[model samples]
Target: MTAGLPEPAGFPDCPVCAYVLTGTARLCSDCAGRTLQPVVDPHCPVCSQAVAPGGQCGNRLCTLPLQQRGFSRVDAVAVYSGALKDKIHKLKYEGRRGWAMIFGRLLVGWMESHPERMRGVDYVVGNPTHPTRQPIQHIEAIMDAAYTEDVTHVLPLSPPGAHRLVKTTETPRSANKNLDDKRTAAAEHAAALTWTGDTSDIRDATILLVDDVLTSGSQLQHVARRLRASGAADVRGLVLARVPWSG
Candidate 1:
């Protein structure tokens, strides 16, 4: 639980089934045998839409102009609902920092299984936390503990970089808002963001941007566009959860 103490490689037992887990095991090695599922089911690789099986939509919603600009692909480990949402809420606000280790392990496992999606990644960066928000050092610690030999965490963003992505002139707490309201607020906030970093470092770099969840994806899109503008060769997103659009 301390910052420097090593996080456990995996959860001690299956949170759902109470089955004992072995070292580094993700699922309950004995019970129902349901492995963690990736969010790749008939979803659009660009926008994460749950398209009909074998169906592809080449329309603007599916093939937004941003997709063609710089970001090449997007992938997620789980849907942003039910157990996943509970876990995220716990990690982000409820002091259950241990959950981050499990999430990080899941991310590493997914990347290993789908190496193609990880192509061109030069650095791993989590979304910057706002100045008014709690420091994400614990999340970074969890990532450090769970990081495989493949991925590397880069420098933490300063207050300026974090604030640069703020869009709405008014800073609002969104914990209680509905999805549509959150999306609207985020989009409005993103439009107000202005880059101030020396983007030269990201130029020609393939950056793997990590976030806890993907809701409307407006936030991710806004940040990815800025990265591209700064000369990043490619920007790919790895979110722990994806909230389905319920419209």
Candidate 2:
């Protein structure tokens, strides 16, 4: 939604290898192929940490905050690296809305592969952006493709809604900040989020939180926390890319 990026040149091609595609293309069907590599495979279901394949972490120490808060699990599509990062940047900042189709396709593929994982999803929600910024239309478009009319919802944490997720206390722009700085900003942002949804409604329903990118897992973590606090029975995160934390 940022300005001066142009309309995205009619959706974007694979940044790595230029391959024209329809709205249904998940990956470069011509050059890179249709399927995409999994992001968090062989990860601890609780903490999403890389572990032995089919391995489970029984100990509480390895549990992620979301799991401890009573959510089931978190699943991402692809690692937030390589061409994925470039595509996400284009979709988010450059107004390349066409890339959203790829993201949606990936989500649908993930859901199909792990049908049980998304079994009882009652609503599809996206990570709320600042009021000044446009809603993540990409996610909505993707969700429309993913769920159709059976499940359609958009939960905003900002204006037009009584609930306020995280508020921006500092003028520090996340994209411009270093990793540590981003983490700090995210923590501050989390503290400012206020829950205004009904505890019982959120508690028993299954909620899927969508975001464009996942870096440091701070934003999702905080949002998950607030949702759980509001009584969300299960909260899962879906992101186009998962930027690994080098630290």
Candidate 3:
């Protein structure tokens, strides 16, 4: 067996749980069973969230109209819970940098499942980060996904060291309290950042925004609004997980 290659039918190590494996395993049987959870059954097609049965967003945590809003098209890789959440936690707070690639690959796999939507997507970007943070993990993952040859939505890398979006918020937010509180906090925190990049390529191009999680979507919304202002034709969100919130 090769040094790093998976042995015969060996599965890759699960990104969430440190499941022990003999060879190059991406996901073990237990981790492979994890999947995206549908928060909204009859979700709005645009935002892709479960809305009130009557078409309004009944989620009390969100005060935006019960109608469709934000990002012309949005999709999540998995529901923000269970093993997926565990993996996301480690990726962000823990030093598990490799999880970024794992999540990025998951996003690519999700895109491959829905190839029709891949058309016209010109750029792939993640939310802006504070200059204080040393390295951005999810960005690295997106870069990896762009290079993976087997994926259907095989995207390419953007400019290296060209992190145009930078977070300006000095203090961290506390939306972890409740859903309603989260919406307000997320929106405020999201506004603290600005985009710093060349507008030449973004104009009239479809941009795929990548992120580890989608809580209130304030970050993505703020960025999309900014992108549209910069002449971007469309903005789509590709998140690793979506937290389920209720009234």
What C-alpha lDDT values do all the predictions have? 0.56, 0.54, 0.58
Whole-model lDDT for model 2 versus the true structure?
A: 0.54
What's the TM-score of each model vs. the native? 0.67, 0.64, 0.70
Top candidate by lDDT:
3
lDDT of 1 by residue, 45-127 (tens): 77575677888744343466654434566677767776667767877876576666566566665565666776667766665
User: In terms of lDDT, which candidate is stronger, 1 or 2?
Assistant: 1
lDDT of 1 at 13: 39
> Which lDDT tens digits does candidate 3 get at residues 108-157?
55565567777778877667556465444455444454345233334533
Q: What CA RMSD would candidate 3 show? A: 5.6
Worst 10 residues of 1 by lDDT: 25-34
Model 3 TM-score, all chains together: 0.70
What local lDDT score does residue 171 receive in model 2, on the 0 to 100 scale? 33
1 against 3, candidate with superior lDDT: 3
Find the 10 residues in a row with the least total lDDT in model 2: 149-158
| Cα TM-score of candidate 2 | 0.64
Off by over 4 Å in 1: 1-22, 25-40, 54-61, 67-70, 135-142, 148-198
Clashes of each: 2, 5, 10
Report the lDDT of model 1 for residue 135. 36
